[model samples]
Target: MGWGWLSYSYWFPRVHSQNVPNSALFYPAVDTDVTPCHYRIPAVYSFGSYLFAFCEQRLDTSKDYGRMNIGLRKLCLKDLGRCEDDSEWSKFCQLPLLEGYRTMNPCPVGCKETGKLYVFVSAINAKIHEAEILKGRNTEDFKLFVTSTIDCGESWTPWQDITYNFNENVPVGSKFVVLGPGHGIELHSGRLVVPGYFYRMPSSFTEEILRQMPNGRKSPPYNNVGCSFCLISDDKGETWNISTTSDNFTYCVVDNMYRHMGECTIAETVPGKLLLNSREYGNGQYRILAESEDGGTSWKQGKVCTQLRDPTNRGCKGGLAKLVLEDVRYLIASNCGHPSARKNLTLWISQDDGATWSKPWTVRDRELCGYSDIDTYMDPSTGTAYVAVLYETGVSSYSERIDFISIKFSEVLEKCSY
Candidate 1:
């Protein structure tokens, strides 16, 4: 595992060893402005002739708890798979939220077949923090809301609360669910798959057990039992269902290494097959990988991808995109490459679905890097396909700003020497 990159390069040599610059690098796509806040958790998707980008506009503070809203910008596609300057994306607007609730985790999915775009977010009570809910000290009033657009970000439908329908099918002990902090996918079969995970209350802890337990055990130990599942919609984004697969479920152990899996993203490898990449709630430094055989309804056991290294203690959220060129499919991922620090942002290419990966190509070598989302698009005129990345990065703090970058598929293959 330690020499995974070296072994991959040995098998596939590059014809051109020189560095080929990226197509475009748009810095500060979302930045802290007048009020002094933050823009984090970037999600990008190619819809229509524009690139739809979204992120969390954390007002007052960058902390997870507080006033937050989803901000979006539609970038115009230009020649060679590049987009117009960030300044030209003047349609920057913030979505409306329910009173006393903060909307977050902007997971956008677009259906080319229907020409509809949906953004799914979690509306949480502003007074409650995630820690309080995880520790069982406060029950979070979490609701699911989704809004759609048909005119390419010109206007959006009113927020429709779908909490009841989604909750009714969730597991009995489910605490709450978190949507993709990135983007979702519309499968070839017209299935809308949104990757997410939720925490569940441990059934072993009862009143009798609490009474006999010690002081440390008497207090609600953080409910670390979690399962990664997909929010599936068979008829476009009209209705949804939850997957009850047990393979990706995990409970906290004595070492606290196998905690909850959350902030997941999904990509369809082939027809009816999907790959899920998730962030860990514990100290595991490797990203958890799982596969679904039946279009994200059920998943195989979640295992650590030794090649995909992440920082310990709540692994950072990464992005995954599926690309095909010359009838060959490749899975591209982006995240902070350093094992201990949120720096060294890099891109990895997986030739065999996800079984093996090529050596990483450094994106940002020495700066704070955070959550990222990846999607591929083609130039409307030239038909040149490209891989786009929207990620959080800063010199001092990872959440200080969000940046966007794009590179041609041919150049990516050359740069990574895959």
Candidate 2:
């Protein structure tokens, strides 16, 4: 058990650290006209001896607000520092992962038991308009889909439409549904869970206008209310089901904050227990917590974890993962540790499940550090444990490039200790 370190407050004093030593950063340079922004929500999955990473390659920004195609790259876990040689990374496909629709938020999960990898993605009809949305036209325009790879991402199956699986259980008037822009989880018992959210436009236009208006709102507006949930699949990626959605009313402290449970990440705390850490827009500094005992089919609201504070009250999405070293379980989280800006990208450790966390170990202390994803890679030959974080970083803004940093298990333990 990892309880020996539980007595001490895990929170370390914020230090002006610079970067993780022996880490490499990879940047993909492309002609801006063809690809405007990478729209950094990068996801990494450790399969066998290789690591697969993905991001949204935004194309035609002038026309489409955020029209992008999924771009994938792979690197050997043993050769992290050598990724800078463009030839070392491979871009398997140029065509959009899912065509005809505008896709965002790609969540990738791998099942070692079945040796299959699943990628869950969300898409909205690029041509749909606000007027049509208001009239309940093409309400299913915003949907979730999944594609899988049995050959370690060398090839992928056709995009499978799984929107109906969630729509059947979503609340009335729900107009939007999305999956994690990060990675998903496969429990010890072989159950697959992908974190996601569903939302409906408010009855009154005021809430919608206030929330949607600021982000350069235009003709086709986005939904204002978001309640997080998990898409659970027991039969691998063949079939799926929806979990009980988070209770927004009771979980949120302020009435105005009720509608904004944004992107989420899930990790198994123990044998049968799962913890969900979600991004709350109205209350950005604190992350919302929820728990599920029955394999993510049902969830109970947990209090806000002020110990896990992000930079801004308008919180940005982060990454979470669970690791076991020497039979001691630890949870690792990555996010901007500040409370007002997207800087001080740090990694936090929790020894006692998700109850408490150690002081953050700075990953990158820069202004434009945005969304990130975490995954563990264990070398079978030497039994070495390594954690890799794929995050967004830039000098002036958040969207210049996506970088991958690999930290050894010893490095994490050394930095997390007092």
Candidate 3:
């Protein structure tokens, strides 16, 4: 891609050129003090027709280098769309962010079958890295916290630990897949899909470091990676089959040009096909994409759609929002912000299930980007799309807050112009 902007490559499908700038950008607003760069975001539909934003609030004191926490918020759709003159266009009410986050991860999805929004967040009480500098902390506290809402976002219940055994393992990608919501929907034959993964800590740091991480050392043979397996459930996420390794896929590539497969989100397209989006950090760059037609148990491969490239902006977590606007099935992915320059947020589309894609547009182009995760819902009856993005505003991870890019898919792809 060229600097500032590059003309749509010939490799791109031929389509009319249009500029759609969302209204939400007009008066971007901030809600809380991130303290030390907070941006891994995920959002789902609100009962009130609004959007709920999620992210981790990291607080690292000079003396305490590895300390971190996560939080959530409730925001209106038009707020991120920047559609109105009302001050609420970008306002957020911080919910009781999880306490003692230390090392907590959160992701959410709405299940139309159950009519309740559920979240599969990573919960850890303590994490101890073998590096002499990384000991004494609680290195054994990570569980998935599932919360939900029935009456819009008017209220929320305490987190319910869906994890079967603290030691057995957990199945989580960047976030869990939503077969439906509330209890989740079952197939006609009485089958259901709930995707998650478990991580294996290192046996010892890999030299230079006290104990090598199981996957690899902190620095790596420069390359240390492994895959988490999925734990399936047929009874609406109540009971799960044994965890299984995703056999169809492999770890990310590490060329002199690329680094690793960062964090990610998964989606089910068509009937059995699944798509994965990830955040990679290394070589001072970021890229994302993973696809599987076998129900996320494994995949076909990874596609580095250049259009999804955000040079300097560090992308975080993101989701898939499907739409058949003008006879095309589009999946818009976001990285909150790329580590590269002028490139922050993006919305990409894939016509062939999740196999291939067309050029995507940039949205929520904020400079300070962190864990950028998104989830969208379409009024099945109206085809009105509502997308929510989690992003930071300041200049770096040190300055952050939880804000969303709330807008209708039509308003974004058809009406708004950048």
Candidate with best lDDT: 1
Per-model TM-score, in order, reads 0.85, 0.83, 0.65
Judging by TM-score against the true structure, name the best candidate: 1
Per-candidate alpha-carbon RMSD to the true structure: 5.6, 7.4, 7.5
* lDDT value, residue 333 of candidate 2: 87
How much lDDT does each candidate structure score?
Answer: 0.74, 0.70, 0.45
Per residue, candidate 3 scores C-alpha lDDT tens digits across 1-418 of: 5543433333332233232332222112333344343333334434335556554444454222255543445555434443333245324334344565443455554555556665555554445332321232333344456667776555677777654443333323222211111112222333344333322223321243222223333533123333323334455544545435435332344332223444555555655665665544433344556665556556544545454554443334445555555666667665533334433455666656655554545564434444454556555456566665544444454234444455676655552222
lDDT per residue for candidate 2 within 284-403, as digits (tens), equals 567777788876877775457877875555688888998998899998888877667776678888898888887667767544677888888776656678888888777786666777
Root mean square deviation (Cα) for candidate 3: 7.5
Total colliding residue pairs, candidate 2:
8
- What lDDT score is found at residue 247 in candidate 3? 52
For model 2, state the Cα shift of residue 228 in Å.
0.9
Where does model 2 exceed 4 Å of error? 1-13, 21-37, 62-64, 81-87, 95-97, 129-138, 201-223, 244-251, 254-259
Better of 2 and 3 by lDDT: 2
- Candidate 1 Cα outliers beyond 4 Å, as residue runs: 1-34, 83-85, 137-140, 204-221, 244-259
How far off is residue 120 in model 1, in Å?
A: 0.5
Candidate 1 on 139-171: residue-level lDDT in tens? 547878899988887889999987877655676
